[model samples]
Target: MNIYSWNVNGIRAIQKKGFVEWVLKEDPDILCVQETKAQIEQLEEKLTQIDGYKSYFFSAEKKGYSGVAVYTKIEPLNIRNMDIKEFDFEGRYMELEYKDFNLINCYFPNSQSEGKRLDYKLRFNTAIMKRCNELVDLGKNIILCGDLNVAHREIDLTNPKKNEKNPGYLPEERDWMTKFLECGYIDTFRYLQPEETKYSWWSYRFKSREKNIGWRIDYHIVNESFVNNIEDAVILNDVMGSDHCPVVLRVSVE
Candidate 1:
């Protein structure tokens, strides 16, 4: 099964950039998108009615702000939000329970300049980790993927030294990621290609994409028990629509 995750930045905005066409061509078994920035009613039929894929959208209470979606050729057995009111209102997290595993698509809130929202972001991180552990304790495999809004290590970004005090690369954010991975979850891309420097998200300023000045913030993280089934994890920097490209996880379901 080929599962792809992307931070589309904005669903309507990307539609003008051939987002639908790209989806048809790439044809992943499952596509989890973050930062949809649109409600179901606000979208046109074309986006909601893509061929051969059933789409599920959970939009934020706020208009055109934070939202997430999943387009799957294989319909999930169950779909649910994390149900934590503070986090739920942002439309950040969802669970697509398949026969054997739960697929979570999440958009971590950006800890704005000088870590203004660092406390809130850290709480969200802890909540997610707790949810993952609870499922794992029940023998559930998890495929957690999306824009984590973090670059776990120095190698995950282009200029780690320059970005050390920045929002996404703050020491607190990196420490949480380290702690998350230590709690029975695996960062698939790093686990698969330890030394590769490919990135999924780039800054729109300073010709960042052109200069390859980017950070690998988007990810496909799975539980350690699911590692054996993870065939490959990749940062699809070649594909583009938003500031972030797609991260792919290929696995064997059978």
Candidate 2:
């Protein structure tokens, strides 16, 4: 199965920039989207009615904010949103249960400059870890993907030293990620290409993409036991509609 994930920034904006055409061409078995920034009612039929796929979306009550979606060729047994009210209010999480595993597409909250939203983001981080543990306790393997909003290690972003105190690269956030992985989840891209220095998201300012000064904050993470099922993990920098590019996880799972 080829499962893909991308942070579209704004679904509406991308639609006008060849998003539909790109989806048609890639045709992944499942596509997980983050930062949809649109409510269900606002979505054009072209997006929801994409051929051979069933689409599910979770939008923020505030509208045009944080949101997520899943377009799958294989129907899920059920779809779910994180029940935690504080986080759910922002439409940050979704779980799609299939026979083989649970797929989670999440758009983590940005901490912002000077750690403005740091407290809230940290709380959400804890909640996600708990959720992952709950599923594991129930004997479910998970394929978690999306923009996590943190660079786990210095190698994950350009000039890590210069970005040390930045929100995405903050000590607290990086420590949380380390703790998350240590709890039995594996980062697919890092597991497959340990030495690769590719990035997924770039800044719109300072011509970041042109200079390749980007961060590997987006990911396809899975339970350690499911790691063997992955055939390849890739950062599809060539495919773009937003500041972030799509990530591909080729795995031998239903």
Candidate 3:
């Protein structure tokens, strides 16, 4: 099965730029998107009725800010909104439970300019990690994907040395990822291609994408039990609609 994840920045904006056509062409078994930035009522029927897929959307209580969505060829056995008051109100997390596994599509909180939101982002990281562990203890395999809003290693972003103080690459944020991996979550792309220097998200300023100066903040992280099932994990750098491109993970699931 093929699953894809992307942070579209703004769903309506991307839709007008041929996102719907691109989705039909790629035809992933499941597609998860972050930063939808719009309520369900604001979406046109074309996006809501994308041929063969059944789409689910979660919009933030504060309209047009932060939201997430999942489009799947197979209807989920169950769908869950994480409902943690501090996190859920922003519409950042959603879960689709199949018979054998659970898929989580998340848009982690970003530490905004001047580190104003750093504390909130850190709290979010801690809470989600706790939730992941709980799911694992329940004997559920998890495939977690979306824009984590972090660049976990020196190799993850261009000029990491120069961006050390930046929100995405800060020492504390990177350590959380290290701890998460140590606790049995595998970073799919890094596990599949350890030495590749590819990125998913680029800055709109400074002609970053043109120069390939970008950060691999988006990811498909799976539980250790699902590692062997992963056929390949890739960064689709050429596929562009937002500052962030799409990340695809292929697996041998039934």
- How accurate locally is residue 39 in candidate 1, as Cα lDDT from 0 to 100? 93
Evaluate residue 68 in candidate 3 and report its C-alpha lDDT on the 0 to 100 scale.
Answer: 98
Supply the TM-score for candidate 1.
0.99
Candidate 2, position 235, lDDT = 90
The alpha-carbon lDDT assigned to residue 214 of candidate 1 equals: 93
Q: Write down the lDDT of every candidate, Cα atoms only.
A: 0.94, 0.94, 0.94
Off by over 4 Å in 2: none
Per-residue accuracy of model 2 over 44-116 as CA lDDT, tens digit each: 9998889888999999989899999999999999889889999999999999999999999999999999999
Where does model 1 exceed 4 Å of error? none
Worst ten in a row by lDDT for model 1: 232-241
Report how far residue 179 has shifted in candidate 2, in Å.
0.5
Q: What is the C-alpha RMSD of each candidate to the true structure, in Å?
A: 0.7, 0.8, 0.8
lDDT of 1 by residue, 156-252 (tens): 9999999999999999999999999988899999998999888998999999999999999999999998899999997888887899999999998
TM-scores of all candidate predictions against the true structure:
0.99, 0.98, 0.98
